[model samples]
Target: MKFVTFSHKKAGHHHHAGVLDGEQVACLTEAGLAASVLEIVQGAKSALDKIRGGLTQAPRYALADVTLEAPIRPGKVLCSGINYKGHAEENPNAKMPTEPFFFAKLPSSVVGPDVPVEKPVRSEQMDYEVEFTAVIGKPLHKASEFDVMAAIFGYTLLNDISARDVQFKDSQITIGKNFAGFAPIGPCIVTADELTRPDDVALKTRLNGKLLQNGSTSDWLFSLPRLISFLSHYVPLEPGDLVSTGTPAGVGAFQKPQIFMKAGDVVEIEAAGIGVLRTPIVAG
Candidate 1:
C-alpha cells in the first residue's frame, strides 16, 4: 500500500493520512482509522490491518483535488553520505569510508512533492541528489542486520538539496543541507511488503527536463541492513525516524562547467515504483 499525507483542496488546510489507489486516495482520517502517518507507524501491524480491511469504506478523493505532503514528519532525518561508489569515485576529494558516514537534515527543512525549494541568496551553487529513504517501524539500539530488516516500515524518496558555496565556505555540511524547503520528500511511502526489492531499486534526477543523475541501489557501497544496524548502535532509532541512503553520482558541483539551480527551474527525482518527487526552484 502507498501511504500518503495530504490536504484536500476544498477542506481548508488540515492534513490527513491516506492510502493511495492509483488516481484515488482513501482518506484514513475521514474513515476514523488514523490521525497521522506517525500514528500508523507507531501502531505497526494492527494499524496496517485496519487500514487494509476498512479501505473500501473510507472517504475517497481524486489526485487533482488534494495536495500531497511529506509522508511523515520524522523525529530525525538521518542520512548516509558517499555510500554510493560512483558518487565517491566522481569526487576527487572524497575518500571511500570503511563505515557509513552519516549526517542529519533538520525536520523543518522537509517539504512535500511539487513544493518550491528556495535558492537561498547565500548560495550560488545549489545542487540536487535523489536518495532512497527508509522509514523505521520500531525501536532499534545496537541491532543486528537481521533485526534492521524487520524494523523497516516502508520506503520513500528524498531530494538532498545542497548549497555548495555555503557548505565549502563554512566547512560544514549540516547548515548547507538544512535551508528551508531543502529536504523535499514523498509522493507516498510504499509499505515494505509492497516493495520486495528495496536493494535494487533504480533512481534518477532530472534538472529542467534533462536527465543528469542515473543510478541504482545496486551500486550502493553499504547495503541497507549494514547502514541501519550501524546507525542503530549509536542513535537508538524510533518509529517514524528516517534513514536516507545517500545518492549516486552526477551532482552539479562535479560537472566540468558546473550547473546550479535558479528560480523557475524544476527538479524531478524518480525512484522506481515509488513515483516522481518534483520540486521547483524559487528565488529566496
Candidate 2:
C-alpha cells in the first residue's frame, strides 16, 4: 500500500495512506491505523494490514485538496559521489576512490515535490544530479549483504543539487550539498515490494523540459547492497535513514560549455517506479 504525509484543506496535518487511484488520501489516524509513516515502516506487515482494512470504511479526502510533505523524516542523509562509471570518466583527472566516496546533507536540506529550489545568492554555479535514494527500515550496524537487503524499506527519487562554485572552492563537498532546499527528495516513496528490481531501475534528469542526464542503476559502480554493507561497517544506519546512490554523467559541470541553473528554471528528476520530483529554481 502507498503511504503519504499530507495536510488536508481543512485539517492542519497528518500522515495518510495514498488511495483511490491517487485521487484521494485516507488519514491513518481516522482509519485507526498507524500514526506516522515511521510507525508503518517499523511495523510494515501489521500496518499494511490495518491500512488495507481501513480502505473498506475510512473516508478519504481528495488528493488535490491536500498538501504533501516528504514521505519520511530522514534521520540522516548520506550521498555517494562518482559512484557511476561513466560519471567518473567524465572527469579524467579525478580518480575513482578505492572505497565508496560519501558525503552528508543536513536533513533541513530536504524538501518535497513542487517546492522551490532556492538559489543561494552567494553562488552562481548550481547544478543538478539525478539519482535513486534508498530508505532504511531497520537499524543496521555492520550489516551483511543479506541484512542490508532485508532492511530496505523502499526507494525514492533524489535530486542532489550542488552549488559548484562553493563545492570546488572548498576542499570538502559539504558546502555544496548542504544549501537549504538543495535536496529535492520526493514525489512519493515506492516500497520495495512495489518494484520489480529496485537496484536496476532507470533514472534521468531534465531541465526545463529538456532531458539532461539519462542512465540506469545498472551503471552504478557500487551497488546498493555493497554501499549498505560498506557504510554499516563504519556507522550504524537507523530507520528512515536515506542513502542517495549517485548520479549519471550528464551533469551541467561536465557539459562542453558548462550549463548551470538560473532563476525560473524547472528541474525534474525521475526514476522508474520511484516517481518524479519537480522543483522550480528561484532566487534565495
lDDT by residue for model 1 (1-284), tens: 99999998655668999998999989999899999999999999999999889988999999888999998999999999999999999999999899999999999999999998889998889999999999999999999999988899999999999999988885779999999999999999999999988889999999999999999999999999999999999899999999999999999998777989999999999999999999999989
lDDT measured at residue 208 in model 1 versus the true structure, 0 to 100: 95
Count of backbone collisions in candidate 2: 0
For residue 27, what is the lDDT in candidate 2? Answer: 73
- TM-scores across all candidates? 0.98, 0.94
Which regions of candidate 2 are displaced past 4 Å? 13-20
Q: In model 2, what is the error at residue 145, expressed in angstroms?
A: 1.2
Model 1 stretches with alpha carbons more than 4 Å out: none
Error of 1 at 222 (Å): 0.4
Q: Candidate 2 vs. truth: CA RMSD?
A: 1.7
Clashes of 1: 0
Compared to the true structure, candidate 2 yields what TM-score? 0.94
Give the clashing pairs for model 2.
none
